[model samples]
Target: MTTGRHAGSRAPGSCAQSAPLVLALLLAGCAVGPDYHTPPLSGTEAPQGWHATLPHHGSRMALAHWWEQFHDPVLTQLVEQADATSPTIAQAVGRVREARASVSTNRAALLPQLKGSGSATRQGGFGGSQFAGGAGGLSAGALNPTLGLGTITTLGAQADASWEIDLFGGKRRSLEGADARLTASEADWHDARVSLAAEVANTYLQQRECEALVDIGAATLSSRQETLQLTERKFRAGFVAPADFAQAQATVGDAVNALEGQRAQCAQGIDKLVALTGLDHDALNGLLSKASAQIPAPPDPGVPDVPAQVLSQRPDVSSAERAVAGASADALASYRSKVRQAVQEVEDALVRLDASERRVDAATMADAQYAKVLEASNARYRLGAGSLLQLEDVRRTALQASQSLAAVKLERAQAWVALYKAVGGGWRDDAPNPHPDHKTTAPTAQGRTHTGSAS
Candidate 1:
């Protein structure tokens, strides 16, 4: 019975010795985590029974050539130059490339970390030769085995690798995190693109709006001069009051100050354009001419049924989402980061929405106020109680008011787009029901459907 027990124990030891190798082979096909499926994209379904976000049947315009949407060749070329020359965009692009490479590296490390190494050395030591007293005479080792018997030079190269196999899904989860970050980079690139395009449009719009202001100011100045003349004549003929003359003089002074202020603003706009372009402001002016480039109104294909993708397609949305993810990852990286910070970021994104709404409200109110003043002044002037000076003031005020409203609307549009961007709201290239803007149609010019570039 003792002999049988010993044999049994020996057999179990033999099996245990082979277990690791068998297990290694068995585990070859497995990876960790529920294999990474890209997070589901939103906006696949039509909203409210009408085609979402695009009621207009327009086709996809290469947002890459977004400036072309304005039908401005000059704008296209200028934008191209800006893309090439702008350090900011270049930096952003570099970051994208870096992120892509890092992800590749992360994925590579997950496979197998292999390394080859070699070393060579030459040394001499006392040898234990069998010449003296039939003993290998090595004085170094004769006293003890501390010294090697002989010196050997070795050259070797080997390929070695080890992997934890991600049995717990830690590394695999890490890879998923990396992939999410990569998509985040792509989203950031898109955000830069959208932002650049919007800025260009804003500048162009501002330049035109400034020109409108200048025109109004000049008209007002002329009317002020006319009023001053008539008032002087009235004082000479003894039919007008001194108060009227003084008011006329004051109005003319105000108009002059206003015109000067506007000229400064127009100059400032030009300066901004200069900074945008690597070229000198004067050179750009020569090219662009202070004469307004006719702007094409944005196509109202229809109100876009905003996708439920409140976070997938919008840059800001994606950015904010990434921030949340990043914060979560950071929190994981170190327990020092409180969960409250992550929660706060989400709250911040929500607050941005409220801020945007408030801007729209403020703009609308300002515009309404200006409109009221403009109309009242014009009405009084037409009734002949108000002087031409007052009429010019009204006209200028009305122009500014209208422009303010347009600017506000532009801001609102931009804010909505930004909110959508911040929320990760957009159709991926592979999305089934793409936005109508993603559709294609022939480009139109200033309403004539001409395909001319801007000058």
Candidate 2:
């Protein structure tokens, strides 16, 4: 009897323990899809350090606010204006909002849904009428006994609830994909900002360089006019030939042509700036006038030696990586290719930046040497010891050297901008999440809250 009593008591305990085990098995079965895993980079894919020499020994700068490093308030203001008004940035923001909505929709799908309905109706009859409501009927006679007319009223209400049970983890996987896409959209927004800033800076630099060239052209024209005057005086005294005088006139004509061309180039640059800043020509001119006509020196953007570290900071790369995470097995290969391309871009930018630095140094020395030669030629020509042909040749050489210097400086500045963009303008994976007003925590089937991963 004691054994029987003990066995009976243990039956409920066994069922209680077995019940949880059964529920766990069911839950495990519902988790049908494979969990996402980050792909690891091979040694060849991720280098220990950069192959090209690091600029300024990889000295770091605040890459996120890279424009501020130039110390050009005009540039900063222009970048800010572009950021606010750029259609590209607006599109990106729209995409981020769309992704955020998708996440909310998918998250809501994982929870229960409830619906309620209510209805009321009234009927009149000449003789009598009856209305049904919840197994009871209202008789017309109860409403009006004196007349043969009567009215009946009916009212009904109902409530229903449903839960989808997640049967095969499809909803969860969908939510995961939505979350990744949202992250990618945010990264894309940052990428747009970085690209726009780099473009604006490069255009601004070009405009300044154009103004400098205009100045050079004006000075050259003045010098040629002086040479023409000198040649004319000598020709009248019969000390120089008519051919020399004609050649001097042709030189002045060429200078005038070149100066006009330079002015046109400067004007075109201003037009581009106006378009980029969304400002009218006059307003843009007013802003540009505040700053001197000189190329803003690009500050060294500290690049990390580790390829993976640098890639992580790039918004495009981050977006690509998220794509890989969210992509199906069939689409994974293509997304991985984008990541490889991003790495190649960084390496290419580094090589160009290194080469441009060397070019600038060489060009500077050549410009200085040519200037001295031109100065000596001018002095000799003024003293009537050098031929006009010799003086003109020296002048041309000096001008070419100066132009080369300017071109090389522009190349170096462009390289800096490219490198800045390559490294992601200092954007980080941990940047603040977009649409903070939206809830990140989703309710689970068991009434527990699951917080989404940070962007």
TM-score of each: 0.59, 0.87
Candidate 2 Cα misplacement greater than 4 A, ranges:
1-24, 126-150, 426-434, 439-455
RMSD in Å for model 1: 12.0
> What are the Cα lDDT values of the candidates?
0.52, 0.77
Q: How many residue pairs clash in each candidate?
A: 36, 0
For candidate 2, lDDT tens digit of each residue in 14-120? 99989977896788686756677667776666667788888777776466667777788988888888877888877887888898899899999999999988766
How would you encode candidate 1's per-residue C-alpha lDDT over 117-197 as one tens digit per residue? 765544455656432221322222232257645554444456777765655555655655665555455555555655665
Clashing pairs in 2: none
Runs in model 1 deviating more than 4 A are 1-18, 25-32, 36-66, 73-78, 111-170, 293-296, 301-306, 309-311, 316-455
Superposing all C-alpha atoms, what RMSD in Å does each candidate have to the true structure?
12.0, 5.4
Report how far off residue 434 is in candidate 1 (Å).
Answer: 25
Candidate 1: what lDDT? 0.52
